[model samples]
Target: MSYGDDSKKKRRLAVIGVSSLLLVAMVVAVTVGVGLNNDSNENVNDSSHKSTSQVSPTVKAVKAICQPTDYRKTCEENLQKAAGNTTDPKELIKIAFKVAEKHINEASKKSKLLEELSKDPRTRGALQSCKELMSMSVGELRQSLNKVTDFDLSELEKLMEDVKTWLSASITYQETCLDGFENTTTNAGKEMKKGLKVSMELSANLLGIVSGLSSAIPSMEAFSRRRLLQDDLPVLGHGDQFPTWADFGTRRLLAAHVSKIRADIVVAKDGSGDFSTIREALPHIPHKNTKPFVLYIKEGIYHEYIEFNRSMTNLVVIGDGKEKTRITGNRNFVDGINTYHTPTVGK
Candidate 1:
């Protein structure tokens, strides 16, 4: 071969060698990428498995607790979402309240929309009533939520009773909303009914849970009695050692006379006392009394309801006894008063 031909052949060989190196580098890169992708997929699967395992126990706990509820599926879903992995019954109850609150709020919004869209007079009236009822239900659920954390096991029965009463009233109000449209035949009423059904179901389920739990548990009073019998007496504080509000004269009289009276005002049903009636004496008290003012109610039934406002601080009522000095009234929810405002004696 000529010298130029030989040099051209050598150049071709060098070009082929470089092409082979490039091909090897590309193959290695693709292999490394595939290996990394497999590792990433394995890691993702492992993480998913771990998360699911962690959540399984919580789901089981929620299912067990919610099994007895009227709306078990709904209770499980809502409690699972709100409580995450917590298995505490108290926490579950709180979450149930929150879910009920949310449901009621949504129902209230829907009712308001129905009220606004309602053209027929009867439908509008019904929706208006429904809106108010839903609003009240939301308020009651919120109050229950606020008080749940403060509940002592000893008072569980009372708490459950109160919860059941409020929720039952809420359910009744929802039914009443539906009843308002019983005689009517309108799409608006149907729509409102559809919107309120979820909220009603949620409230009913909460009530069922509370009732079931209360029934299943042993009497808290019995538990308390056992505890009191077993536990030592707690050390008394300074306030417990002596009466905080006794005046010097009252304190001196306590040493001499076992039954002595000291009061800022005396109210009696008979005309023999300083005031003939509580209503008459209420006006005579100071508007913003700083010190403690005692209102001594004598032994007689006062057929009147009394309300003390926030400004009436430091005023204490000293009754002869709960049965002897009675304040009676006929105010109630049936009288078209809001349940919250139907209290015989309220602040």
Candidate 2:
């Protein structure tokens, strides 16, 4: 070959060699980057799978427990988060009660803050009512918790009744809190509603679990009959003067002789009893009555709007007859009296 041709050929070979080296380096870099990315993704997938696969025992239990509830997702999330990995049913129940109690207490606190934020009197009143009702609900929840904490499946009648009553009361109090805000255009209602929503759900969940507690417990059905058969049959019996609704206490009171009724105050409106008017006798009622305080309202058309408030607990006011004893009042919404304050007899 000639010298020029050989030089040109050498230059071409050199250029080809450089291009091949650069192409190989680029391929290797691209392959390594892709490999690294795939490895990173694989690691993430493995971690995610591991996390989901190892479902906690408590989570499983919560799901099972809340399956029959009205608010399943809420119950599961709340109970699962609070109880962690424990699977014990009793412990789960206690944890559920605690969760409800805690949330209700927090709502009660928030209602006070909401009251402070609101300037409208009606809103303030509603907030105050919410605070009071939430407070009562918390108290009822605590009572239910205590019963569940050291309860008797053997005394199924009393235990079940008590638990059901308290839980129902708690749920009712929460509803009452919301009800006060109803039929009004108040922003506080939304805040109060939002604040109380979860607690109410928790309370309902607690009640549902407790209602099915017989099945949850081992061999509770066998002994449930013992107490219920003996105690419940008579109470459930439909008969004579006492209606189905009246309890043994009220039935006994209604059946008792007039002479047996021990009265702390009496009203006759004819200067025959302890006081002429019902309002006059209210002031004489004991400031604090742990026992039953009987206020015998005689047969008369009393022209007064009576109200028994929070401080007056266990005051049994018996009248002559439903038709015979009449309470009349003229104060009404149309006559300038506020609707709330216009009730003839309020408690």
Candidate 3:
């Protein structure tokens, strides 16, 4: 071992020691950086989770409107309030039906349409549909009422009550529309024409609702007492035998009774001649006749528009067969035609 050799050994040893210290410092710094980063990330996640848990789902304000405890009083109050706040016809109709149902006289129950309402299921269904329409109309009226600024709440309530009475009378009239005219012919023939005529009147203007109803009640009561309410005579028994229309037996009886009204002329279309539009014949119909212009439409399709003035009262358009006969016209809400102007397919 010489002095030069010792110096070289010390230099090598120093170099090895410095390299070991540098490696240890780097490992400690990396461990501390990773631990701090994990703690910060955990805090951020916890805050985010708490926020989500505290949040709530949104609710609608309109749905908060509560139903009334006393359906009558509540309906009346809500109706008045809604009418004052809105002008929706549907609301008015709602008030109307409620009023009618509540106030309907038990002893004075009358309606030609209602006479068979229980016996014929179809009449009941039609009545339900008519009621739904009335409700919808009232809703629309409610919306309109809400928009009016000048109406006091009490005034609106009173007016709505009156409207309800008028509508009730109208519905009753609709029921009795068929009972106005009588046929001395076979019971079935008479009843069928009556049913058809009642349907025709109902399909017309809603204005005649009160007058038509006022006249119909007494007639139904009288018919009920006489057992003449069962208009469908000759109860065509189970499909054992079929009767031909040309036999001239039932047909003659029907023609004789219906013709006496003097307000109608039936022209059966045999395909040999063209039909004059409803527009053409309406002018000739007399107002003084207070009778329907009965059109005994043959089983065929009539594609045209039909319009009737106030004078076209007691009108009836009957088809030989519902399936073979169609009176179709397309009019929608956007077409500017009133909801009542929509076309119908009837028998």
Candidate 4:
């Protein structure tokens, strides 16, 4: 071969070598791209799998409110983050205050929901249940407030205002329900009245759920005034703690029957003819006392059903035991009625 041809041939061979290297680089690039795409797809799948693995914290938090515990720790933690506080109760208080405000807002929403439900017959029961649920939420919120040691007064005041507003609405709803029940005349109407009565009793009991450290809360004031009146308060039998029949009676007899124990009504099995029945005797029961007409039944079987009216706040029943003395009645649901809806086992 000539020298020129040999030089051309060498150039061509170098060109071929450069082209081969370029091809190899392109292959490696393509492989890397495919690998990256697979990895990305796997990452997406893993993320979806993780989401399916468990319930969200929001759901858990919402559920926790209905649970027996107050979830104060969770509230404290959440408030801490939101209000930007660490270590000091002031921060915790700020957080607590915010949480309480949030709860109050939620209560307003729930109250509105209830009002709407009341307008719609289909939702009445559900609305009533919602009120019960919110009552518990109110309790948890109050408990959180109780845990707070120190907080900003201005913020606390604002939050308390919200709570008071909700309480006012609740009281109105409760009283309205009681009045409706009280006015009903038919048998079914009376049964409905019983349900409302139970609800009203529960509503009254929930007043204790609030923590009124100060009179800043109006509901607190209502409860306080009501409590004061309880001293000379007539008992209406809504499940309060008191001494047993014998102890209660002995104390009364010692005080003076016609004077100190000069109650409008009294119930005792030791009296003439076993005080008739609990129902017949309820009418004779006086509303003049500062406490319930003391019904001290001696240990015996008193087969009857009993209930206290809305104004009957201090009805004290001293039973011997769940076994020894008895208030027995056989009422059940399968008889085309709610087990809770009965006329004689009435209120």
- Best model number under lDDT: 2
Mind giving the per-residue lDDT tens digits that candidate 2 earns over 1-347?
99999997886575445433332333344335544654667656987555644766556566656655788788988887888777655567778888999999999999899889888676676778777777778877887787666544344445656788889999998887777765555688888789989998888888777766534333435543545354655643345665554566766776777678987888997789999998988778875566667889888899998988656865778887789778998885445333455679985
Q: Candidate 1, residues 1-347: lDDT per residue as tens digits? A: 99999997886575445433332333344335544654667656987555544556556556655655798788877878888877655566677788878877887788788778767666666677677667767766775666444544444555656767777877887887777665454787788777777677778887876666556435334542344452344322233443434445444544442136577889888877789788888877776776667788888988776766546766777777787888877876445443434456764
What stretches of model 4 exceed 4 Å from their correct place? 1-87, 90-123, 140-144, 147-266, 269-295, 299-317, 329-347
Worst 10 residues of 1 by lDDT: 230-239
TM-score of 4: 0.30
Against the hidden reference, what TM-scores do the models get?
Answer: 0.50, 0.67, 0.27, 0.30
Pick out the ten consecutive residues of candidate 3 with the lowest summed lDDT: 58-67
Every candidate's lDDT: 0.65, 0.72, 0.38, 0.43
Q: What is the C-alpha RMSD of each candidate to the true structure, in Å?
A: 24.2, 26.3, 35.3, 28.8
Task: Put the candidates in TM-score order, highest first.
Answer: 2, 1, 4, 3
Question: 1-347, model 4: which lDDT tens digit per residue?
Answer: 99999997886575445333332333344335544654667656987555533634333332222122134344434443454423232332334444544544454355445446354332343344334444544454454444333233323333344444444455454443333322223233233344344333323322322223223334233322333343463332224343222235444554453433443444456665346466777776565445446665545666777765534546555544567666777655334333233334443
Task: Please report, as a residue range, the 10-residue window in candidate 2 with the lowest summed lDDT.
Answer: 18-27
Give me the runs in candidate 1 sitting further than 4 Å from their true place.
1-55, 219-221, 226-347
lDDT of 2 at 184: 55
